[model samples]
Target: MALIDFSFYSSIYSYNHLFLTVLSFLVSALIFLASMRKSKLKRVNLPPGPAGWPIVGNLFQFARSGKPFFKYVEDLRPIYGPIFTLKMGTRTMVILSDAKLVHEALIERGSIFSTRPRENPTRNIFSCNKFTVNAAVYGPVWRSLRRNLVQNMLSSSRIKEFQHVRDKAMDTLINRLKAEAKANDGVVWVLKNARFAVFCILLAMCFGIDMDDETNEKMDQVMKLVLITLDPRIDDYLPILSPFFSKQRKRALEVRKEQIDFMVPFFEKRRKMLQNPESDKTAISFSYLDTLFDLKVEGRKSGPSNEELVSLCSEFINGGTDTTATGIEWGVAQLITNPHVQAKLYDEIKQTVGDRAVAEKDIDRMPYLRAVVKELLRKHPPTYFSLTHAVSEPTTLAGYDIPTDVNVEIYLQAIGEDPKLWRNPEKFNPERFISGGEDADITGVKGVKMMPFGVGRRICPGLGMGTVHIQLMLARMVQEFEWSAYPPNSKIDLTEKLEFTVVMKNSLKAMVKPRA
Candidate 1:
């Protein structure tokens, strides 16, 4: 009886052990399969781009290519199509050249793609930690600053109030050009006088004070120094390499100090005027500084600091000056190069304004003048690329997975010249705009055929003001003088060199004779 009981217990124990072993193996296999599936799901499908060496990425290749960064990317378009990736140090940049893809990302997914990438340390120092409208992150601070600018200063009514300022500046510009032409044998440097004129207008609007030529020149020089400091540095892309760029960093800080010292007195002057009610009321016109003083940013307990004020003023002045001046220069160059276009434009101006100065209101009446400005901007955008944009969240652009931490840039020139979008894209034709292309929205709201001032929510708030400046100046220039290429029959060189804006490699030099 005992032997039979032992045999039964032993068989039961063996059966239980076998069942537990099989259950453990099944669980392990299932976990392994699940992990494999998860790994596959996490794999990102990034855009096609030239492969680079580990760590340093395409930095060496780009440096070795001996081409401007934009041109380098332009060359790659044939290889990788419109959208492609470039790895610069630890940073990943996605370049979009296709209008459809640009519209899709910057418009359809604007909320996700409108934010700015983290600025470099140097830029942050100047921007007061991204407090200015152009540099601020996409949030309450940006909304508050941008709203303040648009409503208070750039509004249509407000712009109309500044007409006298523009008129005075125009007079100064025409006088300066005529004097220079007289002194230099009917030859004048277009950009130099154009920039000074625009600067005068902006300086008055910014500080509510009209400075003499000497002071204006000094301020211009200081602003130029500030812009030089703002240029991109090697350390900006690779922070780990920052220690080597101590000299550059030191110079940037020094320039920042100089900027603050130069601008603070104007702030104090404005403050005093605001405080003393008995001060000359005529001398006190509403200025951007006035608005900044009263501004209440969303998250801040107090108004912008003096440092922040300097940065904001810099942004406002720098934003309008080089861009507007560059546009004027390019427009004049195009007029000189294509005399037929100039003649047509001049005839339109003559019919509209008729021997009088081109007023702001007259700009609205001339359609061909508008077309000429559009074509100039299309061919020579102020900047090669729009302000750097970033994704608010990880998203897919077209078929490619765009990570949240990458810089997104739209090649403005490439889109403007896209063969698929414009017929005979290489030719300088304003007539296209008068007909089918007249509907071409520079705002890129309806659809993006060309985006000179950028598009979507982050589009340049100064778009209206900027266009007005360009059109009015171009009209006045053409109506007041007969412009021809310098040195008699020499061709106006259209070769571009990138600066704060894409400026002509050889600044436009023209011979001017006053119109009858």
Candidate 2:
């Protein structure tokens, strides 16, 4: 019995050991092959860049660089040419720095590069799986959302409709500035006021609710939470670590809950108002919310759910306010730095509008003022890379083969500052835009040189609204007051820090006095 037991145990152990050894070897071989395959794929067809490490890819490069991530991409421009690729996590990221290449891909082949990557989980949760227009994949829902937003809120005619809203908001800003000028001895923080003004305008347009400073500040904090929660987190990129890093997810959940609590009431209030036909006086006015509520797609009976509605509203407010405010701040900063430009703008506004406050309609006659806004947007675009775009299928861009389902980033700053495109690109000169006999069109349809609001099918839906907002605000400020660096000899610090937008590192604090 003992002899039989020993033989049986030995045989069983030998077979089990053999199987375990084989399995381990197979796993090692498979991993090695996968790595080799990825390495091979990277070499062939892809545009040139530093060979990012295996698995983690270029993520380590991003972490170790200790610089704004976009600047890291910019540093590679000379070495890898304008168009290059970086493998980030399991995704392939293609960066287009050449204006011609960007024009070719985003403008010429718009549809192919219009989709978004599945890279950001935080965005997915925040968006509720493509509920918002910006986060949606290229499909029917995206089309409907974009079409609805553009037709109702952002079309040229629609922008004209909201001119009164812009003027009211500008008045608030002007009055606040005047008060600050008097109270602070002519030194005022420009960005805080700019943010408040822009937020108030957008909030009013979004919900038909005029925002006082307190309400505006409250919503501003919520929107900031939205931005923070929605931003790409480390756990999002390396999902394997998500279990250990639940803080971001928890925060996102909390923010989402807060969003629902904050936004659902607005929806319900409008819904109730619409339902009650007898109370015409109390009925909600036509606004972005009303449009969203009334939206009817061809095939759908039920419109966007409350969550989707909230996300859309949040996106609308966030997109319009931050980018527009950033542009206004940059315009003011530029004007302060180059007083001649400011004086020229002031003279143009004064000649056209006189002592009367600058109006939205007046901006049309003030070409130099328009040029100033364009030049400012060109020099300091709110977003360095317009929201990341992806290809739904394999496509060729600028004579390079692009893999399917890869992320693409168009470097707006690179195109804006190209030496070939503009003379002395770094210089603050609005004249370049007008001197060429045609204004440098911000809309990329005419040309793709510098698109601050992006270009092509995915161009920001808020372009018209934002352009008008900035131009109106800038013209009014220039018309009403003189802007200068707080200290006589100090220059406006142009140092930028990237956030939801690229903002001035130290916000513009300028001395102001009413124009005599």
Candidate 3:
């Protein structure tokens, strides 16, 4: 009787377990089917795009094309018209290559199209879970952070206050370039020195501390590692494949830790200075970190934490560094490629400043100099695409449904080179702005003719600062030295490669000779 009772209990236990398993399976199936039904019910008239395969969509084709993603997108533009959709793994990207369409989406309906897409896992680690201004969702947090940065550091008044910072950086850059040219037989790597100079300016503005070359270089390396690790991985789009990218994820975490370790001391230093202003005589009177310390975002009780501070400062530093440096390199390349344009610019600078250094006030008086800088930007905008934007809610753009889940990106290069917008857009002509060829509205406020610095609400907050840096650096470099192509007569190869920004494939090697 005991044996029979034990057997009966064992049978009951097995039956109960089996029933629970089946029930769970059925529930999961129902949920999936319901989700499918709901998705089907939402009638979305998505923009026309190439047919894609199951799960991976057009990712495989894109990967197999062996073309830079930007070039690949450009190739698709003629086939799919101005606006088209691309299914990149599980994520949807709607690319805008037309000026009108970009203006309509980013300007006419700026509010809906201002938010950033969900960052990949690695980016999230560095972005401090979207607490940084650029990565934050379009909301009170983004507004507060952006407002604080602009008012405290990037505003016209505030930028004026940092003139000494710019002057010092410029002097350092000129001295370094001269030394580099002398050391290397008059051949200096343009991008390397330009990046260092911009980084110095941004670093001082960020922490209010002037670090030594070794320390700054170390920090710069950390920033570069963070950028490298943050590059898009397959697992970012397809979470199911994450196990395959374990090494990448691990490296990303390591880079994040390194970034935090390097940046935290700067924050602590600033914090102490804020506490006792007289304690640190070396600290600048103010810094972007100072504003961050006092910032109170809408969902936080106190100011940003140490990690968040690092993220914000990182964004501030990295944001302007690469773009400004790249711009300078491109501008210099153009001057080397077109000697007439360079001569004209030199004439303008000489007439404006008269053998002295190009000051901030002198930039406005030099129209040709401004035009040359503008033309360089129009030809080679730092990045091919603007930061990815996402809609706040499901909306319609140009009669196509734009879902909140999709990443909306503007092809800045295409817009800048649009034939419909400019006369002879392919040619790099600075006279276009002055000779009435085209009224270049770079800000895109009047119209979307050319947007090197982007347009509308979510435009780069450091736009003014970046432009000033590029213009000033170019002016001083031109005024101090006459830049020509390296190896005497070789052409300045204009082929571009995408790095942190779109940089020269053969980083500009120029023979910079000091002007007599």
Best by lDDT: 1
Clashing pairs in 3: none
Worst 10 residues of 3 by lDDT: 1-10
How many angstroms is residue 467 displaced in model 1 relative to the true structure, after the best TM-score fit? 0.5
lDDT of 2 by residue, 138-208 (tens): 88878898899887777788767777777777888989999988998998888889888888877877886
TM-score of each: 0.90, 0.90, 0.91
Inter-residue clash pairs, candidate 2: none
| lDDT for position 31 in model 1 | 53
Go through the candidates in order and give the C-alpha RMSD of each one to the true structure: 17.4, 12.4, 12.4
Model 3 residue 338 CA deviation in Å: 0.5
Which candidate comes out best when scored by TM-score?
A: 3
lDDT of 1 by residue, 1-516 (tens): 000000000011112333323433443354545445544556678898998644446765676665677778889999999899988766888888899898898888889888888767887889889998888889999999999999998888998999999999899899998899899999999988888888888898888876778888889999999876776665565566578789988998999999999999989988888788457464547799999986899978899889999999988888899898988999999898899999999999999878778899988899999989888888877877887788888999878999988988888878888888889888889998887544578878778988888888788888888888888888888998999998899988889877777789988889998888
The backbone clash count of each candidate, in order, is 0, 0, 0
